[model samples]
Target: MLESWRWYGPYDNIALSEVRHTGASGIVTALHEVPYGDVWTRDAIADRRQEIERAGLKWVMVESLPIHERIKRDDGDLSQLFANYRQSMANLAEQGVNAICYNFMPLLDWTRTDLTAPTRYGGTCLRFEATRMAAFEIHMLEREEAAEDYPADVLEGAKAWFEASGEEERNTLLASIMSGLPGAFDRYDIAGLRKALALYDGIGREQLRVHYKRFLEEVVPAAEDLGVRLCVHPDDPPRDILGLPRIVSNADDIAWIMGAVDSRANGLTLCSGSLGANPANDVPAIARQFGDRIHFAHLRNVAKDADGSFEEAEHLDGDTDMVDLVRALLEEEARRKQEGRADSNIVFRPDHGHEMLMDAERQNPPGYPLIGRMKGLAELRGVIRALA
Candidate 1:
């Protein structure tokens, strides 16, 4: 596996010079400035590549070229959107960046009810409390039949939380879930949320799967033609939170996705933190099973609670056996080498580190604190070096 770091473009607090100090040769990033549905011009991609190269880092993977919501929902008549997306892929591959990491998650991207959950070490880690999230969905967002989505204990817990929360707290919860974390994607207020959710009103899991497969059928061919690997990231938390459909969550989902398009270009990101949030997902086993198709990896762990709560754990400390997972990925790389495959080394980043030490004062995006991720990268590096 090749070590990499995710750098939010020019305005990111951790500069390219600092990324070098993290001991990662590869940088995973995207042109976040380019608005939704807009083409990432070849010139823009080149300029970004030049910047990373100038700092002695290679832009290994486009962390995402975000899919438009209109494209995801398939409101019919998507010729232009598909054309633009294909153009973006062509532009990226032409710029010598072939690996693209993206997700088909609707509405929100990795929702968390609490941004600053306290850790035992006096640092903060990202967390999702089931009851608090339920409260937001039931009492705050007020989605019709949202209460039916939760069990009796969760609904009762949500009631208690909702009644006790002040207006400010309620508003914070709304922003965290709806805003798509500011730098990630578009922001949605209550009206915007309702409008977006309404788009998927009649679309359940099956219909959503239809739209997803349709998307792959169109885009995967373009990706293959462009010599680009499009890796679909697993659904964060591996479940539907806001009543949206889930297509890529478990091993079965991965098998279906791989078979859907059935091309080497159609790959998986293999985000451990996201997939490991669900207890049933055996992280190491999945890595071994789908080893060849995994083009990218997000290596982080989480401590799970019985009530669907998950707190970000240190790189090797969570429920998933980080060592065994790394071993599996290494074994795949070794196999690829023996087979003389071109994509032998998978690109991986230390994902979603806790806000530790001076990170509290740094105020980088939640789960993206420099010191925390530096620590995570170092720990993961130690694992790789020892195993390899």
Candidate 2:
């Protein structure tokens, strides 16, 4: 894996100089300033590339050129939207950026109820509490029929939370879940969200899968033409939250996705933290099977609860078998080398990290504290070096 760190463009608190110090050679980023549905002009791509290169880092992956909600729903000016996407691909390729990571999650981009929850250590970590989430989904956003989706325990828990939560706490939780986290995507308003949902109305899981297939069918050819890999990130928590359908969760979903485009340009992001939130997903096995097609990787772990709630775990201590997982990925890399493939490097990032040490004082984004991820990257680097 070409070790990388996600940089949130020029506005990020963790600067490129800091990223260079993280011992990562590659930078995974996007033109977040370029608004939704707008084309990432070749000039913009080149400028970002130049900035990273000047700092002695390569722009290995376009963390995303976000596909607009309109495109996801197949609503409003799709011809123009897709044209923008294709143009963005060409622009990225022109600047030698290869891997492109995007997600098909609707309404929200990777929701988490708590960003600063206390961890087992004397620091803070990100967590997703199911009951608190249900409270927001049912009582706050009031997604129609949301209560029916939860069990009795979850529903009651949510109700209790909602009743106890102050107005400010409730509002913050809603914003966190609705707004795209700093590097992920932008936030959405309830009215705007309903409009996005209207596009997927009456569209069930199978239909959404078909829609994704149709999307890849269109996007992958362009990506292949441009020598770029379009890697889709899996649904966080690996389940349908907020009544939205999630197509990429498990192995079957991956198989279906790869079968759709049937090209190396179409690939997976393989986020361990996201997939490992589900106890049933065999993370190492999935990596081994899809390793050839994985262009981007997010390595983090989660300690899952019996009730389906979870907290982000330290990279090496979580339920995910980090050692086995790394060995498997290296094996896959070895296979790729044996085949003499000419692809861009596989990009990996420490997906989320605990807020530890001085980082505990810095008001960083949830799961993105610099010190914690630096520790994770250093640990993984040592493991990789020893194995090599």
| TM-score versus the correct structure, for each prediction | 0.97, 0.95
Best by TM-score: 1
Query: Can you write out model 2's per-residue Cα lDDT over 262-317, one digit (the tens) per residue?
Result: 99888999899989988899999999989989988899989998778999888989
Tens-digit lDDT string for candidate 1 (160-254): 99999899998888876754542455677777788778888888888888888988998999998888999999998788878898888999999
Note the residue pairs that clash in candidate 1.
none
| Candidate number with greatest lDDT | 1
**Where's the lowest-lDDT run of ten residues in candidate 2?**
179-188
After superposition of all CA atoms, the RMSD between model 2 and the true structure is 1.9
lDDT to native, each model: 0.89, 0.83
Candidate 1 runs further than 4 Å off: 179-185
CA error at residue 90 for candidate 1, angstroms? 0.9
